[model samples]
Target: MFIKIPLHISGLWYPIITNNPLTTGSIGAGINIALYLTAKLRNTEKCGILLNNEEVLKDHSRAICGKLGVNLSVDEKSPISLGYGFGLSAACLLGLSLSSLLVKNITIEKATWPAHVAEVIYNTGYGDVIAEFYGGLEIRVKPGPPGIGVVEHIYPGRKVDLIVSVLPGREDTPSMLKRIGKETYDLARKLIDELLEKPSVEEFFVKAHVFTSKIFSYDNIDKLLSPYRSKIIGYFRKKQALVLWVENEWLDEIYSYLNKYFLSFKTWIDMYGVRFENTS
Candidate 1:
């Protein structure tokens, strides 16, 4: 049988790195896309990670499994491209943990730390596991794991859709995290305060785009997005990837407009976070 888990993309974030994994997370906002991972699970004496279709993540998966203590076979049907800011690493860890725990009859509460700790140790992601685990659009005010971190949800007042456009090349997350300077973090901290004041979904994209522009050379995509900006709600970047939020009525027009400039995918906001979808 297989278990499905929700996937997410952080709209804007500032990492809160600390020596302890429990306290390590990001202060940011994200949307839970409808995309999910299908993990095949079974009972076994030893934990095995058949992730990446047994082609890659052997070591990382094994290490995570050793901590969780159950077997998992990752199905390739979930096609979240790595390093394009889809938050795949954390998603996989959560998927693996959930699958493992399901077979063992353990509470899902035990699942997050192992995945979160792994992300911290590996320097793969911050705030993603917790945010993805919770679902919906959130402004993560505190840094750390779920119970340790604090997040405030932003109700857009109406449901919206998410559009993802991955750029030509992938950016290394660890390297990107390392390159973030203190000035940027300082600026982001202040931005977080500003976001908290009148935090609406629309304000998030506007402020988040400011942070994106500060770090990356966003001029190219910025220009490409200009004409469609008015027609859509708002957008922000995570490295080379761009995520656009739009109203349901504008979905067709937005896709048609982006067709000339980029290859994009569509999914609506998922209010529910990661959970046991089904087993079959």
Candidate 2:
């Protein structure tokens, strides 16, 4: 049996991590970009993942299987890089869990729990699983496990274009989390709240760019794209990569101008969360 699941982009938002027992650290909503995970199940009793075509760690998938008490050979594929704030790892784990739900007749809430737990346990992500589960432009109002977390989102009333530029390496999210302080989280919360008051795609880009700039330092990529600053709505540094929001009409010109600088692609917002397809 086979199943495929889509992925989401972790965008500009606050990080809610702390030593305080009363508060839980969670990510705010960003955009859901176009990425995917397709899982193929075989007769063997093992699970694994492949990025593009190369094999990678299966710990997250294994964790889900252990919780569900089901073991089968699994192959997962994705186009997005693993540690670039694209939520590819969360997507893979969730995809496997969702597939298990359909194949084993388990409830979605139950199936997704392990995926969410795996992410939290491994420090892979805080809210990507929950946001990906809901899809579209999501805002996580409260944080916890999937059932415990609360999310709200707006549908893009019109078509919007996104250009994601991936740098040569990956960002260690766990390591990055250690450097983030409460002040960062406070700023993110403040901006997100302001954004929620009047939600629009333009406002989202503006707020995201502001949040990214406030939290992260300017890098060479920022300098490289400075020439086209006026044409692009806003650009934000994501993990070790960068994502630019552009008006739909300007996509072609921006793509042409920036394609030579880095590995880039143009995608739209994914309103639907994870999807499933069976190919037996």
Candidate 3:
């Protein structure tokens, strides 16, 4: 049997990186992109994972299977790179968990809890599993395990094209978390509150750009994309990639300009979260 799940792109509002039980909650809104997962049950008791045509470490997936008492072989394909703030790790866990749920006839909450726990325990991500499970643009109001966290969705009426460029390397999220202090957290909280007060597509880009610039320096990015400044709404750094929000009408021009310098693609919002299919 096989199951499929969609991948996600979160515009991280507030990146929470601490393992400290009190200070480690994140706030972000994300969209489900075209990238997807297909998991087939293996005859053996072990689990395997393939990411973007490349085999990856299956420790997390194996951990989930060990806890749930099921085995799977998963193939996840995407145009983007893993650990680029595209929520690939979270997607994989959710896909495996959902597949286990369908094949084993387990409850949704029970199936998904392990994925959430795995992310929190590994410091790979916080709030992404919960946000991806419930589709659309979501805000992580409070953070903890899947069931313990609180999230709310903000629906922007119009759909826009997300022009993403995966940079050369990956960002170590745990290391990034270790460097953050209370000042950064306080600023992020204030910005999130302001955006939530009157949530709109325009406001989201504006505030997100501010937060990104303040936290991670965008001086080089500003100089690189100077010519197309007017057409671009805003840009932010995600893990190790740069994501630009552009109006659908300006997609071709913006993409053309960005293509010359980086590996770029255009994708739309995915309202649906994880899905299941049985191919026996």
lDDT of each: 0.74, 0.71, 0.69
Task: After the best TM-score superposition of candidate 3, give how far the Cα of residue 111 lies from its true spot, in angstroms.
Answer: 1.1
Please say which candidate is ahead in TM-score: 1 or 3.
1
For all predicted structures, in order, the TM-scores are 0.89, 0.88, 0.86
Q: Clashing residue pairs, candidate 2? A: 16-25, 17-25
lDDT score, candidate 1: 0.74
Model 2 lDDT tens row, 1-280: 4555556665555656555311353757677776566676543456655556666547876777788788755567766667877777777777667767645876776677777777877888888877887778888888755566788887678777878877666668888777767787687888788878987778777777776766567667667777777778766776765778887778987887777876788887788776666464
Model 3 stretches astray by more than 4 angstroms: 1-4, 13-25, 37-44, 144-148, 277-280
Model 1, range 9-86, lDDT digits (tens) per residue? 776678777888889888987777788766666335545454555544555677777776655555534656567777
Ordered from best to worst lDDT, the candidate numbers read: 1, 2, 3
lDDT of 3 at 234: 68
| Model 1: lowest-lDDT 10 consecutive positions | 42-51
